[model samples]
Target: MRYKLIPFLLLTGSLHAQQTSVLFIGNSYTYANDLPNTLRQLALSLGDTVTVASSTPGGYQFVQHANYAPTLTAIASQPWDHVVLQEQSQLGALPFPVTTTQASAAQLVDTIRAHEACSMPVFYMTWGRQNGDDLNCPDFPFMCTYQGMQDALIANYTALAEENDAFVAPVGAAWSQVRALHPLIELYSGDGSHPSPAGTYLAACVFYCTLFEESCVNATFNGFIDAATAAILRGIASEVVLDDLTAWNLDVDDVDASYTSSTNNGWNAITYTHGGAGTHLWTSSDGQSYTTPDATFVFSAGGSYTISHTYTDPCGNSDTETWVREIVVGVEELEHGMWYRVYSGVPGQLEVRGLRGGEVLTLFDAQGRSVLQKQLSRSAERVVCLPGMYFWRVNDERGNFTSGSVVVR
Candidate 1:
C-alpha cells in the first residue's frame, strides 16, 4: 500500500510539473456550485493541484459546445491534459441515438488530438432527473422513470467513451450508489435535473479519484455542503470509483512487485509482478542505472542489488515500485530473439541480445513513436535509444516476432 509516484510523463509548458490542467466543457452540471473552481479548491485542500477552467452554458449539449465561441476559445487557450465533456442533463437519453452529441464529441477528440495527442477526452456520465423527464416521456417511455433514464444515460455515455477510446467519469453511477445507500442526501435541486451543492461535492470527489488515481475519502474539501453530508458523499464516491477503477477507465499509480533470485550456474533470476497493462521500466542497484520494463531479471554477479520499478499508464501517469535482495549469478548462453531485451546499457554503446539474422528490429517510444530500426544479422545487436522509455519489436520479413520495452536512462 505504501508507494511513490513513478517518474511522471505529462504535457507541460515547463519542467516544474505539479498539477494537471483540466478543462471542463458542459452546462449547469459543471458550472453549478462553480464545479471547476470547487474541484480546484478540493485539489488544493488535498495538497494536490488541478488548474481548472470551464465553458458551461446552461442546458448546453456537446453539440452546443461544438460551436460555442467561448468553448472553442477555452479549448485553444492551453494544452489541456484532460477535457471533461458533460452532455446536457436530459440529452443523454433522448428519443433517437442523439447523433449530434456523438458527432460533436468525436470531432472534439480529433481536434484535441491534433494539438496534444496525450490529451484525454473524458465523458462526464451525468445522473438522471431526480423524479424523471416528463417532457420527453411521451417520446421515450424509458425516460418516464428515474431508473430507466439513469440506465439509458449510462449506456449512452459508456458507448460514447468506448467508441472514442475515451475515459468516462461515472458520476451518475456514484449518484445511484449514494441514492441507494443514503436517499436522504439531496443530490439534486428542486427542478430535479441540476445538481445540488451536495451533488457537486460528490462530483468533485469522483473527479479527484479519477484525475489523481487516489482515494477521495481523506480529501478535505466539503464545499458549501455540511461535514456529515460531505463525508457520506465522499465515502460513496471513493468506494464507487476506487472499487473498480477499470469500470471508469481510471489507472491508479500503484504496482505490485516481487522478485526471486536463484544461484543457477551463477545466474540470479529475478522476477517481478506489477498489476495492469501499462508500460514499465526498472532501475538497477546503482541508483543511476535502469533497465527496460521487465518482469524477470538476470544478474551475473554475487552481491545485493536493488531494482526500482516505474510503471506508466497509457496517458503517461506513473507509479514507482522497489525490490531489493542479494543474489549470485554465473555466465549463461544468450537466448536470442526470446531474450531480445536490454542485456546491458552502459556508456556509448547500448548492448541488446536476442535477435536472429533476417529479422527486422524496430524501436518505439512511450508515445508509440518510432525511434530506431535495424536489421539483425547476428544473434546480438547494440541498438541506440535516447534517455526515455522504449520498446523493441522484431519482425521476420513480413512481420512476426517478439517485442519488449527497454529503458535507456
Candidate 2:
C-alpha cells in the first residue's frame, strides 16, 4: 500500500547565528526560582548573548500591569530586541470575570507601540500549573481545572496577539505535552502554585528555544539539589516529538475508543461505511491503518466522510491533519479563482483593508463594493484612499495585499 509521508522541519542549525537581548515582564511564572537566570545560562552555553530584564511581582495580571503602565512603558522603551509578557494564569483562563484583561492587553500593546523602537517584536507568554491547582488564591471555580483554564488562557493570548500583530510563546501547551508524556512531571511545587525547579527549567527551555529558534541541551541545575533529583530533572528537561494519529476505525455497534499517538505529532483519521455493514478507516499517514473488531464493517457505496485530528508537541507545538474519503466516488476538482481573497488591516482591530491588483489596483469595502482604485507601479507602495475595512483581490500584477494586516494608528 502507498503511504503519504509528512515532512518534519528540524531546528538543528538555524539558531547558531545571532545573539539577542530580551526583556521578560511577568509574575512568578517568569521569575520563580531564577528562571530568567537559567535562560541566560542556556543562551550562554549555546554561544549566544542573552540578558533578561524582568519585573515580576508574585502574582500580577494585565489589569494590574496597566495600572502601572508608566513603569512598563519605561522598561519597554529600552533598546531590547524582544519583549515577553505573561499574564496571571487565572486571569488568562477566566477573562470573563476580569473583563479588564482584554482591555489591559490592548492598553499594554498601545504602550509598547508608543515606547518600543520601530519593528520590535512582542511575544505573549503562555503558562500552566498542575491540575486543580489555584495559584490566584481566591479558590474560584474558574481556576479549578488545569485543562479548562489552559484552554481559556491560550485562546486569550492567541486573540490578543492576532489583534496586536504580535507573536506567542506557547509554554502552557508545552507543559501539557510534557504531562501527556509522563503524567507525573508535577510542574508545580508542594503548594501546586509555584513551579518546582524542574518546572522552571522547562519554562526556561521553552523561552530559550522559541526566542532563539534553537534547541536546549545540558540544562543542569546547580548544587542546590541532590543527585537523584537532578537526574529526574534532566530526564524531564529533554524534548521529544510524539506521534499523532489522525484516524481510527471501530465496529458500527461499538462505542468510541480513544487512542494516543506514540509521540505528540499531529494527524487526522477518517472512516467510511460501505455495503450497510463494512467500515474502512484511513489516517493522514499512508502507513497508518485502522480495522474494526470484527471484519463486518465496510464503507457505504457513494458515501462521503472526513475526520480531522490535532496534537501538541513536547514543547506545546500544535497542528491538525484531515482525513477524507468517498466510497466509489470521484473527487471534485477545486477550481482556480473560485474564491475571492480576503485581507484584514489589523487582526482583531476595528479597521480592515482589502485590495485586488492587475494592470490597476482596486480596493473594495466589506460589502464587495469598489471604494477606491489605484494605478500600479514597480516602486510605489499601493495606497488606499480610505481606511476601515477592505478586501483585495490577488489577480493584479503588483502582488496582492501584504500577508499581514496594516495599522493606521
Candidate 3:
C-alpha cells in the first residue's frame, strides 16, 4: 500500500471551495482579539470559507456556560459544523476539578448534539500563566511552575475531549512550543494571565488548522504582528495540529480508501464499500478520472493498470490507495493441452471454450454462491441471467478443479 500526498495544494478551476461553519463558546481567551474573525480572515487567505460565531463573556466557565441561557441559545441557533468550548484557564489545571469540568462539558456536549447531531465539540486547551498560579500554587505545589501547570492543563483537556468524543485545538501546546523557541515574543500581556495580541494570534492560527485541517504555515493574515513572528507562530501551530492530529483528535473519525474491483469485458468496475466519511475521487493510469465514489472504466488493451482512489474529508485530511491489477484477454492453460477461457461473445452470456469433454463446470456469483453446476459431456455456453462478476470452476473426473473469474455485461 503506497500513499501519495498532495498537501495544501492550490485550488484549480475545477475545484470548489470548501466551506465550514463554527461557533466558539469560551471566555476572554477566545474573544480577546476576536479569534473567530481572525480565523475567518486566515481561512479566506487559504482559499477556503469559514463562518464563525461566538458567545464569550469576560470570565466564563464551562459550568456557567452549560446553564447560561445565552450559551444554550447559541447552540440551538443554527446547525454549526463545530462548537468550541474553552474552560477557565485555571480550572482545568486544578487538582480534582473533574467534577466541575467534566460534568459541565458533558452537559454542553449533549445540548450541542441535540441541536445538531453532526456538530463536533472542540475543547480549547489554554496555556498556563506566564509566572504561575500564585493563589493556588501554595496548596497545589505542582502549579508553582509554568511547565507543571501546562502539563496539568494538557492532561485535563485531553481527558475532557476523550470523554466527550470531541477534539482539542492544542493552543496551549503550540503556545508552549513558541515560548520555548522564541521567549522574547511576548505571548502574554503584562498581567501574565490574559493573552497578548500575539497570544490570540497564535490561538487563532491553531483553530485555523484544527477546524479546517489545513496547513497554516503560509497563511497571509498576520494579525497585529510582524510577518516573521506570525510565520513562526503559524509554523508552530501547523506542527502541533497538522503533524500530530491524533494528539488533538483532528484526524478524521474514520477513513478507508480500500475498494473492490471486477473486470467485465474490458470495463473494470471499482467500488469503495468501506465505512468512512469523505469526498472521493477515482483516477486511473489511463488518463481516466471519476468523481463518484464508485465507477467503472474500460481498458483499451489487456495489461497491468494502476488504479487509485483518494478521499478527502471536510477538514482537508486525505488518504489514498493505489492498486495494480492484471487483465487477461486470451485463454489460459492449466495443464497438458487442457485450456479454458471465459469470454463474453453475446450480451449476458459467458462462452467457455477449449474445455476437455466429460468435465463438470460450476458457475458461482460474486458472493461465491453456486448459481449453476453441470457435468459437461461437451463444451457449452450458458446464458447468465444477471450482469455482474462471476467465478467459475471446472472439475475433471479425478476431482481436481481449476477456477477463474469472468464478468457479464
Highest lDDT, which number? 3
Question: Candidate 1 at 136: error in angstroms?
Answer: 2.2
> Per-residue lDDT tens digits of candidate 2, residues 185-295?
566778766777767766666666556444455444432445554345434333421111011000111222222111100111122211112232434323344443111
Can you give the TM-score per candidate against the true fold? 0.66, 0.51, 0.66
The per-model lDDT (C-alpha) reads 0.72, 0.50, 0.77
Colliding residue pairs in candidate 3: none
lDDT of 2 at 127: 55
lDDT of 3 by residue, 273-355 (tens): 22235587878888888777555666667789898888876544567889886666563423433545555556777777766
State the displacement of the C-alpha of residue 159, model 3, in Å, after optimal TM-score superposition: 2.8
Better of 2 and 3 by TM-score: 3
Q: Model 1 over residues 1-409: C-alpha lDDT tens digits?
A: 1122334443432222246789999988898888888888887666667888888888887887887888888888887888899988888876435457788888887877777767778889999898889998888899998999999888888878877877788899999998898899989987888889999999998887777667777666789989888889888878887888777665422343322111111145543434345676767775444344335556656788877877776556566667676764453423332434443346444465655667777777778988778777887777655665556566665454555555554
What is the clash count of model 1? 7
**Model 2 off-target regions past 4 Å?**
1-17, 73-77, 96-98, 117-124, 133-142, 218-409
